[model samples]
Target: MELPPGWSALLEDYVAHLDAERGLSPHTVRAYRGDLVELARHCGVGPAEVTLPALRSWLSAMTDAGAASSTVQRRVACVRGFFGWARREGLVAEDPAARLTAPRRRRHLPRVPSRADVDLSLASVSARLSEGDNPLVHRDLALVEVLYSSGLRVSEACSLRLRDVDRERRALTVLGKGGKERTVPLGVPALRALDAWLHRRPEVAGPRSPETVFLGARGGAMDPRVARRVVHAATAGAGRGAETGPHGLRHAMATHLIDGGADLRSVQEMLGHSSVATTQIYTHVTSERLRQAFRQAHPRA
Candidate 1:
């Protein structure tokens, strides 16, 4: 859909603001741009020209078109953010989207892999590593171990450098969302696997390669996609049919930690979550487990 000529420039400015001032990732900025562009098309107006009625109608149309609740919520956020920026910049006399409300997002529990499944998967990966001195095998085992141990996001894991690991302390200096830095402790198994990979790292690391801890097949820094593939393959090899990724390992780590009686604040800090509320989701998982156990072991009748 073609937007007014001025709207294009406005969108470019908004995206730049998100990138520069907001420090949003490229992927996130692109999502905001896409959603705002759709709104501009639906309203057939420029940023300043959009009315509250038009904003409401656009949202209604999106919901009526069968958009998921999360999709609608994101779109609403995009509209609100764009107009909020515009209002502050004097592009609009008033924020039309100020009153816009989206459907409350459904809180679906994160899918966590069972401890047995994770154990089996790690056993399978370890068995492969025991077969030979393959550098890639060592790297894969370390990657999965670190992911499960630290609950590092795939991007965070891929972005790690040689200096990020503290060999003596068994800890990692992780840069997480919003460029926040946190130090997370590594388990003994993760430390051992990581040490093994470091020993064999030079065989594949090219002279031109950066000091990235995890290297790609060609010796460059490992891409997040490759890291995800390593996790997926390892999980599948354990005979688990469910789709699992690095983030699933993160979810599993948090749940397992909470189940082991770890405090919410400690888990929140470990996972680098800015808010403790985000870490509270693991309590729900624990509660659900108790519910299942009660149903199976106790019968009032």
Candidate 2:
């Protein structure tokens, strides 16, 4: 759908701001753009002409069309972000979306693989790579190990450079969301996997290769998609049925850490969450597990 002229130009600038200044990933920028465009089309007016009523109507239309609560919430966020930027940049006199509200999103507990399941997956990947001197196998093993061991986001892991890993400290310097930097410790297994991969990396590194720690078959930086595929394949090979990905490994790491007595603040730092509240979701997981165990063990009715 063609957006109004003023809205179209404003959206382009907002998207650029989000990419260059906000440091959001391209996928996120695209989602924001999509949401804003749909809102602009629904409003049938330019940015300067938008009103709170129009915004409410757009949201109402979305709900009437059966958009999910999450979808509606994201669209509300997109509207708020666009207008907030426009007001600050002088494209709009006032932020019309300032008071706009979205329905509260239901907090769904993240699915975490059991510790035994994670171990089984890693063992399966190790066995598969044991028979071969293939660089790809080594890279996959290292990718999964680092993902589970340090709770690194898949994008952060894919974007890692050779200098980011400190062998002496057994830690990685990760550039996480909003351009924040943090150091997370690596486990012994992760260190060994990384060492194996690094030794074989020279075979795959070419003249055009970047300084990225992990390389693809074409001798360039590994993409997040490749990392996700590695996780899915590894999990499936381990005989697990539920859908698993790199983020699932991250959740499992955090859950397991809490279960094993890691403190909340430390887990927050390790996971790169901006707030400890964001890291508290794992506590819910542990509490639920405790409740389940109680139900199973208690004999009295």
Candidate 3:
């Protein structure tokens, strides 16, 4: 269904607001635009004409169409935010999505690699680098080490700049979701890897390369997809049940921190999570691991 012209204009304005005023990341702005566009198309209504029933019906259709609960939940948040902004901007007389709700999302525990397994993987990567001085291998090793050490989201890692690294402090200034910036400390291993990569970076760096800390083969800013592939390949043979990727490495770092008795608030700060509740999931992962170990090694029921 084609969205009305008014609806299109309203969506564009809201997108601009999200980007320029709210300082949301491009990915987040795109997601908000997608959700609102789908809502407009589904309801055949402009922003001002949208009603609560229309909002609910849109969400109901998404559920009926087999969207994941988490996806629907995200859309619900998108709609509520858009409508709230619209109402404040006088684009609508009232907010229709204010009362909207979606199904609760299932809290699935993240897969976390053991420290030993992760060490084995990094050692393997180091072995590959020993075969010859490959810049790509250097970059990959540094990328994985940074992710595992700092618990940075893939986007934040890719967005990192040369200025973000403070070698003396052993910390990186990371820009995370919603443009929130925080300092995450690097482990000694990560700092070593990063030092190695920086030494080789000049060989691959193009003339116009940005100040991004990590770079692609062509010297452009590091692509998250490339970073993901690098991580997956590095960890592919780590021999854990769950396949590890950049995000899995992130989960692993957080889980390891919690396992080592780092406070939830500190992990939350390190991870740049907006809420301690988000950081608490690592505690769940650690607890489940203990349960599995107890079941395996206990002598009596």
Candidate 4:
């Protein structure tokens, strides 16, 4: 759908602001742009002409069309942020989205793999590693170990440069969301796997390859999608059959940390979450798992 010229120009400016001033990721900026475009398409007017009725009608139409509550909530947030920016920037005299409301997005507990499941997955990768000193196998082993051990996001893991690793400290300097950098500890297993892969990195390293810690088969920078596939294949090979991906491994790491008595603030820092509230979900995950265990083990009814 074609956006109003005014909306297009304003959105472009706002996107630039999000990228430069706010340091939002490209993915987030793209989402904001898409949401605003949809809103502008629904309104079919310049930014100055958008009114509360038009905004409400657009949201009503989305609801009528059966958009998910989360989608609606995100669009609402997008509009609120955009219009708030417009008002502050004098692009519009008033913000019509101020009165907009959306359904609360339901938070489902994420399926966190058990420690045994993660162990089985890593063991599957390790067993493959035993066949030969295959560089790709070493890379896969290191990737899963790092993901499960440090709870690094797949993107963060992929973004790792050789300089980001500190062998003596046993840590990785991960650049996370919004370009925030955090140091995450590497477990002994992950460190060993990483060492093995680094030793053989040259075999796959292409001439054009950067100093990226992980590389694709051709030795270019590792793609997050490919990394996700590696994680899935490892888990599926262990009999879990795609039950978890990189993020699931991250969740498992956090849950295990909490279950092992790690503090919430420390876990939040390690996961590079900007808010502690986001990390609190793992506590909920732990509680839910405990309830499940009680239901299975307790005989009293």
Candidate 5:
């Protein structure tokens, strides 16, 4: 198979490992590849020429190029990954990018939509498919249902296998960060949507015996990018504005649950978050809502 432009042969090897050995979702593997390709283009050299100072210089160039801190950090990680792969394959005696560090990004609160906003978004998605213009309607609707209902990432939403979804229990096993798998409940909306999608999934999936729950127009795996586009269009079509993305829906899911008096830990498990600390961030949002309510209702004004 051909590698990404400017990708080192070692990167190609590591990417294979990430897929076959690590069970990393294709989306993540692509991200790592994209970052590495950018690094390779900057270094102007092949795998054997990578060095610590050169890596640092690339980081400096990224900073100068006005890359976001988060993006820059990802680039650094990709460079480090290349070195790690090189050492593992015995191409290098020691990893030169070992001591390199990704830049720190200022933490900002995640964006979560209100109930009205989520309703509009979901309704819009549903409305589009009901029109019959797109045969992938069931697939799109099912994806939206699972995403909003279970709070899955876009990658997880699309990668779901048919067997992973348990019809009797209305639950599915989600493979999340670090290849961790967790069983999450699906609501009636998700179940119904999934049922409808299964009815029409074969139409879009041409001729493959794909066990995947969702498929693209070509009968293969749906790209997360396409999932994102569908979501953006649906949300915009419903007049919810175009500010939010799929993960924003995840933020909305966690926040809505908290707003409905659900425990933070329970929210963490639902989102498949590894850290309670990560889930704790939503508490801040709820607290803000409380303050807003208090200020609005109190006579102190």
Candidate 6:
């Protein structure tokens, strides 16, 4: 297949920049680079020739090739980033790729459990509190509380160590995606759950986990998938829809914060989103729901 001249080398440099400077994981860097490879083939020109028309044509070709909307959209974003980087580094004079837009993706909103539903889920865990018996209840409760309260990713929750919790500050330190670290606040319930679980965790941790916060029957770092499965099973029994997972709890945390008037920028930072636009999806969620409610109840059309 025909490929752009020197495009291969430039792509290597850009991918390296993404890895070393941006701290993107090798896997993520590779994913972004895959699209660039296709771009080189499509454009049939070097990085210097990335005019808007060529960019648009590449996207159109992706559409013709029957790429999924999400895939096409991500490739478009990668192209924009590449061109922006190129222009800023003087590889190009003006960013002709600036005006490019990704294919429109079907919009989806984060699912937030309602107030009554939230009470039911939390209360269900509390009510199922093993009454003086089962050892894993405390760990389970702590997991749910921390997930809903802090909106932590499953990996972050599983990665917790003994030293990461600051009891005095009511904060839990998390190593988020891309190896970024952030401090997440611990709510009262989460703290209490953590304390109780720490007590029982010593009993339940199998032989594996030595220092992680939530441990299995053999005392070791809890497996993330198991944590998710526990969340899935527990949420299913809580009467919420089956769609409720640990991520649903995370979404709930973001929505609860927004409804409580937390600024979008703060939530974006707390969630480790790179763009305010990514976080803005919650605004759309809240606004659309409000619109639906208003239209249904309002006296006027």
Against the unseen true structure, what C-alpha lDDT does each candidate score?
0.88, 0.90, 0.89, 0.90, 0.80, 0.81
lDDT by residue for model 2 (1-301), tens: 6888798778888888998999987888999998888888888888899999999999899899999999999888888988998999888898999999999887767767788888988898889786967888888889999999999999999999999999999999999998899999999999999999999999999999999999889998998898899899887643244338898899989999999999999999999999998899999989988988889998961
Tens digit per residue, CA lDDT, model 3, 1-301: 6886588788888999998998998888888898888888888867888888988888888888999999999999999999999899988898988888779899988776788889988998999987987898999999999999999888888889999999999999998888788999999999999999999999989889999999998999999998888899888876557649988888888888888989999999999988998888888888988999999999873
Per-residue lDDT of 1-46 in model 6, one digit per residue for the tens? Answer: 7566878777888998898888876667889998888888877777
Question: Which is the winner by lDDT between candidate 2 and candidate 3?
Answer: 2
Q: After superposition, how far is residue 275 of candidate 5 from its true place, in Å?
A: 3.9
C-alpha-based local distance difference test score of model 1? 0.88
lDDT of 5 by residue, 42-124 (tens): 77776666688888998898799888998887777777776887788787777879999887776667656677877877787
Candidate 1 runs further than 4 Å off: 237-243
Compared with the true structure, model 5 gives a TM-score of 0.77
Please give, for residues 1-301, the per-residue lDDT of candidate 1 as tens digits: 5896569998999998998887876778888898888888888877778999998898899889999999998888888989998999998899998998989888767767888888988998999976887899999999999999999999999999899999788899998876788999999999999999999999999889989899999999999999999999887743244338898899889999999989999999999988898788889988988988988888861
Which ranking of candidates, highest TM-score first? 3, 4, 2, 1, 5, 6
Model 2 deviation from native, Cα RMSD in Å: 1.8
Clash counts for the predictions, in order:
0, 0, 0, 0, 1, 10
TM-score for each model: 0.94, 0.94, 0.95, 0.94, 0.77, 0.75
- Model 6 alpha-carbon drift over 4 Å, by segment: 1-16, 33-58, 61-68, 80-100, 104-107, 131-134, 204-210, 216-219, 237-243
Choose 2 or 6, whichever is better by lDDT. 2
lDDT of 6 at 10: 78
Better of 2 and 3 by TM-score: 3
Give candidate 3's TM-score.
0.95
| lDDT, model 5, position 186 | 93
Model 3 CA lDDT for position 255: 88
Who is ahead in TM-score, 1 or 3? 3
Worst 10 residues of 6 by lDDT: 234-243
The better-scoring model by lDDT among 4 and 6 is: 4
Residue 167 error, candidate 1, Å:
1.6
| Tens digit of per-residue lDDT, candidate 4, span 199-263 | 99999997899999999999899999999999988877432432488988998899999999999
